[model samples]
Target: MTIKLNLIAAACENMGIGKNNNLPWKLKSEMDYFSRMTSKTIDPTKKNVVIMGRKTWDSIPTKYKPLQNRINFVLSRSNLDLKNCKDVYASNSLESCIEKLEDNAFKSVYETVWVIGGRHIYEAALKSDSFHRLYLTKILKTFDCDTFFPPLPTNLKKVSDPDVPEELQTENGIDYTYNVYENTQFGK
Candidate 1:
């Protein structure tokens, strides 16, 4: 069975992801969009995995560290203890992590696995041929950020956007678009 990888993130015009370990904006619409996109119930036959880099995990608020109801896999070189986290695993390389997950038979049961990130992990996913869909929220603003999402791949095509407002522009002087791309297009 093949692994179905998905990405969920927001980025600035410069692809900046975070500033001072926080999101650049607190748009309610963006939060709603994120919740709607990621709240699907996990398929029991398949395992749902959320992969993130070390810094990204640290960036998450202490209250939300152990994101509820899904397996959390962290990619880190350091031997940090992740308390209150369920099914926590760590790896130095994305490939090795994926291999371990596969070896443990994670894909056979889960319909979709997500690569939730904080910049570096997103870059790794973009370069690899592992993902099937990219769920991005382009915030219309630039921030002083140390992390950023990588550019979208040309091969993917937009598939859905039910909530994007017409003529909607971000308060930060950037024009944003909500796009979903599939790895393969069945027809024009």
Candidate 2:
């Protein structure tokens, strides 16, 4: 069974993603877009899986976590606890997370697997052959950030996605555009 592994994120002009373990900027539209994309599934009976680094999981608001209606997987070498959160699981590494997703139980229940992240998880996903697409929001303005997303691979080609809006979206006085890039060498 082939599972489409996707990476989703929003970055500033400098490719900065976060500051002090939180989002540097507030854009409700961008956050809404992320919520919709990661939670959407083509099959009504199946749910999408979001794999994130431990830090990313921590960054989410406590009340909204485990992200609702989707399966959440956190990658951490340490003992990251989530015993009370429904639909949340813990994996030691990205490889282990992917392995668990490919298992018969998960394969039958889940549709797409999205890597939503902190720096290290995004970097690891970019280096994996299993990763297929990047759903990125290009924030036009620069922000003060200490953490950044890794540069896109040379083989990834920008592709038009009908699901993404073509026009620039302005929120909280900042302009941004949604983009989708597919790996050119993915299936070859």
Candidate 3:
């Protein structure tokens, strides 16, 4: 399957993404960008699939459980009861979750899959080379992160042009920039 899987993340100077199971910083604009990217679909009839670890799924508040229009796929090895989750699906692993999307039931409904993460999920996906593009937000400040985002794969290269968005953004005193890293290692 050559379906495009995009990895989206926000990381601090030290590559830290989380602290105490939640985002360390509260940047409304950053959150908005994240919501907009992951929810976007090329076709109006299809939705994007956000594959996240169970902890990441739990971190989102119950009020925003299904993450609106995105199809939420929580990857966990535990006995997760999918019936309790309203619009979310449970999968044994990230690979299985992605493979299942090709099923007839989902083939027509999903536009793309985004590997939104927790520590383990990010590490696994990067190592497996399961994604084509990484839409990473580099936060200029360092935070106390118990969970960290993994480094880019050796074969991946940042797409130059730091000013793709045309300006630096500062929110809540934290400066950041957006960049895309393409998987040059396996681009063939």
Pick by TM-score: which candidate is best? 2
Question: Candidate 2 at residue 5, lDDT?
Answer: 81
Clashing pairs in 3: none
- TM-score to true structure, per model: 0.79, 0.97, 0.92
Better of 1 and 3 by TM-score: 3
Candidate 3 residues 60-136, lDDT tens each? 99888889998888989997887976558999977787688868877888887888998888887776545788889
Instruction: Report, for all candidates in order, the number of backbone clashes.
Output: 5, 0, 0
Supply candidate 3's per-residue lDDT for 184.
80
User: What is the C-alpha local distance difference test score of each model?
Assistant: 0.71, 0.90, 0.83
Better of 2 and 3 by lDDT: 2
Which residue runs does candidate 1 get wrong by more than 4 Å?
A: 42-47, 161-177, 184-188
Instruction: Please state every model's RMSD to the true fold in angstroms.
Output: 3.9, 1.0, 2.2
In model 2, the runs with Cα more than 4 Å from the true position are: none
Order of models, best lDDT first = 2, 3, 1
Per-residue lDDT tens digits for candidate 2, residues 45-92, read 988999998988989888898898899999999998789888999999
